[model samples]
Target: MPEPLQIGVVVFPKVTQLDLTGPVQVFSSVPGARVHLIWKRIEPVPSDSVLVLTPTITFADCPQLDVICVPGGGGSDDMVNDEEMLDFLRRQAGAAKYITSVCTGSLVLGAAGLLQGYRATTHWSAMDHLAPFGAIPAKTRVCVDRNRVTGGGVTAGIDFALTLVSLLIDRQTAEAIQLRLEYNPAPPFNAGSPDTAPPEILAFMKERIAPFRQRRSEAIGRAAARLG
Candidate 1:
């Protein structure tokens, strides 16, 4: 029999749980696919939300993965400037069949130089930051360029995973998994994006994240310089 498809997700402290969990659920549903949560160490990592995640393998022990995904949150601020994390991703990208990210995790992939010249997407607020890293920012829910796939914000992870599943397996299988998961989304409020949200609500959110965005931009500057 063929070996199972190996997939790895990099889990770090302060990750937005949904960004990781949503994709994991989709990836896990694939038959004959092994999904591994990886980190610097095999320890519980706290998330931006209440849920905590534990890594199944450390970076040192992870096998070459068919797909390597990074999920973003507050933790990504530090990750963008983390040489060790960036180094690990760089090494993995050399052989990983696909390199991907969800939410701000695309920023981490950008920092690792994996996204240079790739068209990618991230949370709306951070989309502009991609250009500094030489990434063409695509403002879509899911963006796929060559072997790099990225999802916008948190909820888009499921869409990203399903797209990946279609590529890795088949559309019929992806549809089956989607049906099994009851993935039809009919959100009560159509305010998920800045374009759809109320003007005041969008302003409020932009204001709320301004401080973090500033810090993240600064870190990205440093990471970009390092890449140069």
Candidate 2:
């Protein structure tokens, strides 16, 4: 039998814990699949004030991967402005057979100049930033264009990873994994998307996240200027 496909997942300080753990759970379920938590260095990284995870491989230690996935959250604003990290993402993603992102990770990819002319999606609040990077912002929870794949906000990572499993392996396997996890979602709230969200809720969220949005916007502008 052929060897299991090797995958690398990049994790950094302040990445949403769910973004990393969700995909890890799905991809690891695939038969003969191996996933490594790759990082700029081999050390414990903290996410949110409570969660800290140790890396399985460092930049110099990672093996070439069939897939490389990056998950993002609050750290995205900083990452988009980081030359070293953006360059590393560009180099690693350029060589991977499939490069994927969850949530604001798409912004990092865009900042790295990998998403130019690609169709991608990111957290809805930050979707507008895609224009500077020359990517068409997709409204879907998951968007795949050639080797690049991106997902919407936090919860969408699970769905996106399941879709990837189906693409790489088979639909049956994906369904089985979903079934095992009871992936049938039941949300008490009806407003998941911008179009469906109540005006007040949307306004509140937008207002609350304004500072972060501004930082990311500024970062994207700088990245675009550099690329230009």
Candidate 3:
């Protein structure tokens, strides 16, 4: 039998837990599908201050992937600036049959120049930076451009993964997975996007993320200089 479709999920220190776990749960649920938690090293990596996940493979040991998914969070700002990480993303992206990202993962793709001339979406907070890499920033829940797929925000990872499964397998399979999860969402809050968020919620989120934005700006600056 042919090798099962291998999907690789890259993890790093301080990665948002949902970004990795959400997709892992979805893809792993599929029969005949394999998912690998990969990292720069084999040592367990911490997610925020609470969780540690042992990666299945390290950068030096990972097998070639059919689908590569990059998750996003605070760690993404650092990964976007790392020469090794950017180089790996550049190469893996070129060779993978499908390349996908969620939230700020699009930022990593942008840093590698993969999003140039593509219409992409990302966590709204970081969407502005796409233009620097020549991408047309989209304001949607998910955006698909040929072999590239990107999702918006943290929760969008689940939707992105399901969409990918639909793309890879079929809509029936995707709907079945969603049904199994009972994924009927109904949040008490009416606002998930910046435009729909209340003035106070938007203000609070911006203020909280200001430092991260500044650091990301500086890091991307350096990465751009190096790329030049």
Best by TM-score: 1
Which pairs clash in the backbone of model 1?
A: none
User: Could you tell me the lDDT of residue 72 within candidate 2?
Assistant: 88
Q: Model 3, stretches more than 4 Å misplaced?
A: none
lDDT by residue for model 3 (96-137), tens: 888889998888888888888899999888888888877899
Query: Ten-residue segment with the worst summed lDDT in candidate 2?
Result: 86-95
TM-scores, one per candidate = 0.99, 0.95, 0.96
- CA lDDT of every candidate: 0.95, 0.87, 0.86
Candidate 1 residue-wise lDDT, 101-147, digit = tens: 99999999999999988999999999988998899999999999999
RMSD in order of candidates: 0.7, 1.3, 1.3
Candidate 3, poorest ten consecutive residues by summed lDDT: 219-228
After TM-score superposition, the amount by which residue 54's alpha carbon in candidate 2 deviates from its true location, in angstroms, is: 1.3
Give the alpha carbon lDDT tens digit for every residue of 152-199 in model 2.
Answer: 988999999998998898999999999999999999998998899999
lDDT, candidate 1, at 76: 97
Better of 1 and 2 by TM-score: 1
Candidate 3, pairs of clashing residues: none
